[model samples]
Every structure is written in C-alpha cells, then in structure tokens.
Target: MYIDLHNHYLPAVDDGVLKIEETLLGLKLAIKEKVSTICFTPHIWSGRYNNSPEKLKEVFEKVKEEAKDIKIKLFLGSEVYYSSTIAEDFSKGLYLPLGEKKKFLLVEFASAVMPQGVSDGLYKLMLEGCEPIIAHPERYSYVQKDYECLFDFAKAQIPMQVTTQAIMGMLGRRAHRTAVKLLDEGLVSFIASDAHSPEERPLLFREAVRFLNRRYGYQTAKRLAIDNPKRILEGKSLLPVAGRKGKYSPFQ
Candidate 1:
C-alpha cells in the first residue's frame, strides 16, 4: 500500500472535484491504484483559490464522514502558493499543514517562474521549525529549463514531491524529463498523484509504482511511494532515496 501526500479530492474546495460524488469516485479509484492513505491538499492561493483554512477543514471533515466506508486514510492539508507574506500567513494559521502534528507544509510556486525569494522564504519557514515540502518542482518552467536549479533546495535539506503523471510521461516531455532527472539525482522525496478529477488527472499510484519499479528498481519505488510519505504523517525524518538502479538494498 502507498500513502499519497498531495491531492485535491475535496469537492468545492479549490480547482479539484466539483461534487461529492466525484470525490467518492476518486477515492475508490485510488484504492485500485494501491493507495491506502491520502492527504487532501487543496490550493490556497490568494485571489485564485483563496480557500479559507477553516472552510477547508470543515469540508474535509464532511468528506471524511461521507467516505467513512472507504478503506483508506484521509488527511487535511493545503498546498499554499508561494508569496512574500507566506511566513506571516502561516503564522496566522491561514494554511493547513500536513497530518495531525502540523509539521510538514506543502508549498508551491508559480508554474511559469520560480520566485526570486523562494529559498529565503523556505528558510524562514524552516527557522520557525516548519518542514517545507516543495510541490511539483518538476512542473516549474524554470526548473524545466535548468534542472540544476534544485541544487540549492537539495542542499537546504528541503523535501520535494513530484507528480505521478509527470513520472509516467503522461504529462509533456519537458515535465517527464525533469521529473526523471529529479528522481535520478535523488532530489525527489515523494511521488504523489496530485490528482484533481476522477478522469482528467485521476489517481496514478499503481501506474507510478509499476513505472518506478521498472525504471529505478523496486526499493527506490517503495521509498518514494511508501516510506517517505509515511514519515511525513508520523512527523519523522524522511529516509534518503538515492535513485540508482540495482544500487539500493532491499528494506529490512
């Protein structure tokens, strides 16, 4: 089983599923994908998503209740867009962190540009004892242009979550290439569905696990798809997943 740490399955929360039915459908599909856990991370961007943290939690609770029959774990969280006031906003409890302990925060930058003060902003969050996980660095245009741009983040010990579609080459070539590079260089810490709808994006956990198992070996796939994500929920340090075929030893 796998724990998917990033997804937007809550209806009317953001740009995800619109109805509760779709939410239920997505969860059922996730089961077929071998996902046993999921963290619902709705977008918390100003003006665009603009979802209030409280509202998100309320909807999350309702969805949890509705999906009680489903055999999977669901968590409440938000994918906050990077902004100059992000630290302050986080302090104000405007963003929901991952899992119950509220230690890991999932953050995203604009798809077209990696903000100038991104490193400084993440550093500030770290200083506050909040572990930040960059969402989909592989999808960033800047990162696509220069994959090495992630070196600073890597050195800072910040974790990153790559989308499953990008890893499966369902996205464009640029995104696929960048995702593979990130995994190949050991910069990716988690592989999530980043699923939005039931069909358009849907869940791809099984596909990703299969693809990664073949491309990077079974242990590497397990680390990103299972172990690392479980650590985030438990508020534990993530184990390193250096991507090299036939190099990683089997988990004992």
Candidate 2:
C-alpha cells in the first residue's frame, strides 16, 4: 500500500483526467497498482490553469462523490507553478497543500529556465510554515545542469519528489538519468506516480516499487514508496537517506 503524493486524476480541473469516466478509469488503475491513497494534484499556475483553493475543493468534492464507491482514498492538492508571489498568495489561502495537515506543498518550476528568486521564494514559503516539495526536479533543464542545487535544497530540509515514470525510463534519457542520479545520491525523498490519465500516465507504483526493491533493496524502496509519504501525510519529518556509491546498488 503506497500513498501517491502527486497525481492528476481529478476530472476537468487541469491537464489530468478530462471526464468522469477517465477519472474512474485512472482510480481503477491506481487501485490495481496497490495505491491505497492518492493525492489529486492538479496544476495551479498563475495565468495558466488558475485553480483557486475554493474552486479546487468544489471540483474535488464532485470527483470524490463520483468515485465514492471505489476502495482507494482520495485527497486534494495542487502542483503549484512557482513564482515570486507564491508565498504571498499562499498566505492569502490561494492554494491547497498535499493533505489536510497542510504541512507540505508540491511545487514545480518552468522547464526551460529556473526562476531568479526560486530559492528565496521557497524560503518564504518555509517561513510561512509550509515545507515545499519540489516536483520532478530532474525534468527541469536548470536542475539537470546543476544538480548540486538540489543537494542544497535537500540540505535545507526541503524534499524533492521524482516521478515514477522518470525512473522507469518512460520520460526518455535525460529524465531517467537524472532520476537515477538523484536516487543513487540519496537526494530524492519521495517517488510518486504523477499519473494524469489511465492510458497515458497510468499508475506504475507496483512496478516502481518492485524495481526499487530489486535494484536498491526493500528499505530504500519502501521508504520512497510508502514510509516517507505516510510521514508527509501525518505532518512529520522525514528520515534522511544515505547516499550509495554505485548506481542502483542494493542497500548494504
């Protein structure tokens, strides 16, 4: 049983499941993959997909009602696009956190260029008592160029979440390489299925967990897939991961 901290299964909210049928299909796939808990993190960009907290709650309720009979649990959050004003907007209650506790916020940066005030922006959020979890940092070209910046974020106790498909090589070579490097270096805190649709970005929790176990041992796999995410939901601090020497070597 894994808790998926990042997913886009809510119907018609963002770039996720477009209709109710698609939402149900995505939930079914998640359940099949042993994902007991899922966080519906639709995109919340400033001028693009501008989803407010109240609006998201209404949409979440509708989707929740539609999938009420499904055994899997549902949650509401936003994969917020990072901007200098994010902290200010969050202060005004413009966004939703990963869970009810509101301890962690899932954030993403632009793919081409890293924002100038990115670090300061995240710091401001932290000052407001919200831990920012950088989503798919490996996918960002800036991060790919200077991964040590990721280490800096991790050192500051800000967590980084990598998508499962990236590790599985479904997102191509650069993403796959970065994901592996981050995992091997122990910079990643959570491994989540950023599933959008049933067919396109289906939940691969079972496969991801199995691969992590086989390549990195049960401890590392379990921590990324289950333990750490559970802690995040519970509003607790995560344990640090020790970096391994060789690539994908089993934990000693």
Candidate 3:
C-alpha cells in the first residue's frame, strides 16, 4: 500500500484544497493514483492556526468520515513551518513527537534564505527524540545554492522529502538537477507530492517512481516509493543514506 506522507487536502483551511469540493477532488486523485493512505498535512505554521491536538483529531475524524468510501485512510498531522516564530516551543510544538501515528515530524522551512540556525533548531528537535523530515528539500533555494547543506542535514541524520514536481523538473531546472544529485548521492529519504490543490500540486508518485526506476533502477526507487515511506507511517527508525560520490565541499 502506497502512503503519501505529505499533502494539504483537508479543505477550506490553508492555502490548499480550498473547499470540500476541492478536498474530495484531491482525495479522488489520490485514490486514482493508487495511494491507499494519505496524511492530511495542512499548514501549521507558527500561530497561524492555534489548532490544538484535540482540534486536529476532530478534523481528522470528520475528514475520514467524509472520505470513508474513498477507501483511503487519512492520518492526523500538520505541515509545520520551521521559523523563529515557534523557535522557543518548536522542539515540542512544531515537532509532533509523541503518539503511535508517527514519531517523525514533517517541517517546512522558510525558503533558501531562511533565518539563521534553522538547522540548529531542527537538530535540537531531533535530539529531543523526534526525527525531522524536511518538506520539499529540493525546492529550497538554499539547498540548490549549496548541495552540501542537504548533506549537513543528512549528517544530522534527519530524513528529507523531495517533491515529485521538483524531480519531474516541473518546479524548474535547478531543483530538478539538485534532486537528481541528491538521489544519486543516496541522500534522499522520501519522495512526496507536497500537493496542495487538486490541479496545481496533484499526486505525482507514480510518475516519480517510474522516473526513479528508469534512472536509478528499481531497488532505489522502491526505497523511496515503498520502503522509507512505510517506515514513516509506522514511526520506525529511519536509516541513514550514503552521500553522493566525489569528495566535495557542502558550500560549493
């Protein structure tokens, strides 16, 4: 069963899945894509939405009830923004550390030029027991600026998710190139659509897996599409990956 770890299909809340109609459309798209499980990760950036864990559960139940016939098991989680706004409580707040759903926390950083020490905060969160899965590492201009920053995060041993669009080169050439580089280096841990709307960021796993199989072979592709993602859903220990060949500086 394919499980999509990141998506914004909760409806009428964040910038994604703006209404119930869009939410259902995204769900159907996921079903059509053959994804049996999907985590509804709406934006939990800073105080933008002070939704408590209880509130999250409430919405998850409602969405699941609505999507019952679709046969997709919806999960409870948030796509938290990694910024200074929650710097103090981030270790506890942004990173959803407890519960059996998943010990891994999915976090999205500000962009290439994010505030300094962003990595440090995530590192701290990791030390506190939650593994941080960086959302859309390929889209981060900072990662493109220096492919080594990703290695640095990898060195911290945190798993990173690459957007299917980035790998498809749909987001742009640089992101595509970097994604390829990361995959070649064996640094990528997961591949997700990070899908927002039904049209703009629709499911791209099948296309992504096909590309990975053609370029990197099936074993590597399976690791991204099948293995690592399964570990996330089960909250298991995420294994580390080898860096790309060639002695290179991370800043270069």
Q: What TM-score, computed on C-alpha atoms, does each candidate reach? A: 0.96, 0.95, 0.88
lDDT tens readout by residue for model 1, 96-178? 89987889999999889779898899888888788999999989999999988887888888899999999888889999999
Residue 155, candidate 1: how far off, in angstroms? 0.2
Worst 10-residue lDDT window for candidate 2 reads: 243-252
Residue 130, model 1: lDDT of 89
> Where is model 1 poorest over a 10-residue stretch in terms of lDDT?
243-252
Encode model 2's per-residue lDDT on 26-138: one tens digit a residue.
88878889999988899999888988888989988988998999998888888999989989988999889987787999999989898888889999999999999999988
Q: Pick the candidate with the highest TM-score.
A: 1
Better of 1 and 3 by TM-score: 1
Model 1: how far residue 251 lies from native, Å: 22
Q: How does residue 85 of candidate 1 score in lDDT?
A: 81
Reference-based lDDT, each prediction: 0.88, 0.85, 0.74
Candidate 3 to truth, TM: 0.88
lDDT of 3 by residue, 128-244 (tens): 666778888778888888878666776667778888888888899998998888877777887888788889888888888788878777666777776788788788875443333
Query: What are the clashing pairs of model 1?
Result: none
Backbone clashes (count) for model 1: 0
